[model samples]
Target: MNKQVMCEQCHKKVASAWVTKIEGSEVTKFSLCEDCLKAFSLKISINSQNLPLDSYFNCLNDKEFYPERLSNFKMCPKCQLSFADFMQTGLLGCPNCYQFFGQQLRPLLEEMHGSLEYKGKIPVWAPVTYVLNTELKALKNELFSLISQENYEAAALIRDKINTVKEKLTKA
Candidate 1:
């Protein structure tokens, strides 16, 4: 038998949405019922059409929920593209729009891509030193995390791996 999870806010309804936020070394997690989640999303200023959450939270489609006129909406200085226009068109007016609407677009991008940082594919023809350098950087990060958690055994293994990558880089 599975235990039912109650909403953290209302505690009366079953939780339908889970939210997690990680800042630096700290992490926070909570679950919300449909109603509470909808209210929470609204409070966060989630643009309806900008995110796929609108399909799940149908209340966002209601015009009454956002009564402000288009003129009052935030606009990009470079392209003059309003956030409202982006929501309606589902397109950014210019590359500068990313910087202009970074705060609002961040959540949507994170939801879709799972991370803000881009880890693009490296071509097979890329230099061996370049590949080894990337591997060394990732191993160092993992080593730091393991050390922070006091996992010396795992950190030792990562340290060995980093040494091997460094040797390969030196040879290349």
Candidate 2:
């Protein structure tokens, strides 16, 4: 009888598929269940270039791989779509999904994109909002210092400045 093998990442599920790579006679294998496999995207560096895991697993379209029927209540209030649905479909229901599933998606995003924070340049049109955000941040820091020093009057002034900047940002 063949022994049962569980997925290495989420050990609660049985291993259904695997990925293997061979380099210079050294072999590495990763076993995963269907759910884990759907969210198992990764980026690896080869010859100073980053490569996506999808390129290696592209054969799935030619081979046998089907999503399982799973359901969960963890859903986005704005879209009414569950996290399980996202895992199965690999698509978010709405923009609110980024906030709702942030904790779960951060690792997947970091693995696929190399970082969670955007490193690109800001848009020229958004400079006003950007400046307001920077000003609001500085004012909040000043407010904190004033509060720590027991200067409530100065803290109130900084607080009003922060609120004004926030209002401008929201209106922008």
Candidate 3:
């Protein structure tokens, strides 16, 4: 019996099929398992339609993928999933993994998504009170800061603004 060949993309699983392409005189060949093939996001054009592959197979195209080189190595307590595991699988082991590996994941998330915090659009149909409520929260915080700094004049001004906003909300 022949030994099984590991996938070219992810070294963890055995490769089952071969993907090949020829352009001009150059020929390219790669081996991938079904799971990795499914995870690869490279879309194929067939009959003018695009087919989306699995997104789970990240880092398949990057030959130098290595999370072990990080200065701090953190692991999830619940699933024993290491940061390296997340790098390889592109998935967190469990829900608690977020809390456990948040420090490390923050940078990765920011790099991939452009920001760590979700800045989703507010619904167009949202109530006018929603905007007033947000403004009131900010004004209240400013009032607290002014009072703490002993600026009674500014604090009173903010206090009056807060009262006006409250009255408006109550009326609405």
Best by lDDT: 1
Off by over 4 Å in 1: 1-72, 122-163, 166-172
- lDDT tens per residue, model 3, 1-172: 1356679999887676577756669988898878878876666555576556443224433446564454234445466566877788898877898888887888899998788878655555779799789879989999999999999999999999999999999998
Clashing pairs in 2: none
Instruction: Summarize candidate 2's per-residue lDDT along 9-83 as a digit string, tens digits.
Output: 999987766768677799989888778876776665656877676654453354354422221445476666777
Q: TM-score per candidate, in order?
A: 0.33, 0.29, 0.31
TM-score order of candidates, top first: 1, 3, 2
- Clash pairs detected, candidate 1: none
Task: Mark the regions of model 2 whose C-alpha exceeds 4 Å error after superposition.
Answer: 1-72, 121-172
Model 3 lowest lDDT segment of ten: 54-63
lDDT of 1 by residue, 1-172 (tens): 1255789999998776677856669988998877887776432335544454445457644577664552226667666577888888999988998988887888889998788988677766898888888889899999999999999999999999999998888889
Error of 2 at 27 (Å): 50
Which residue pairs in candidate 3 have backbone atoms (N, alpha carbon, C) closer than 3 angstroms, thus clashing? none
Worst 10 residues of 2 by lDDT: 62-71
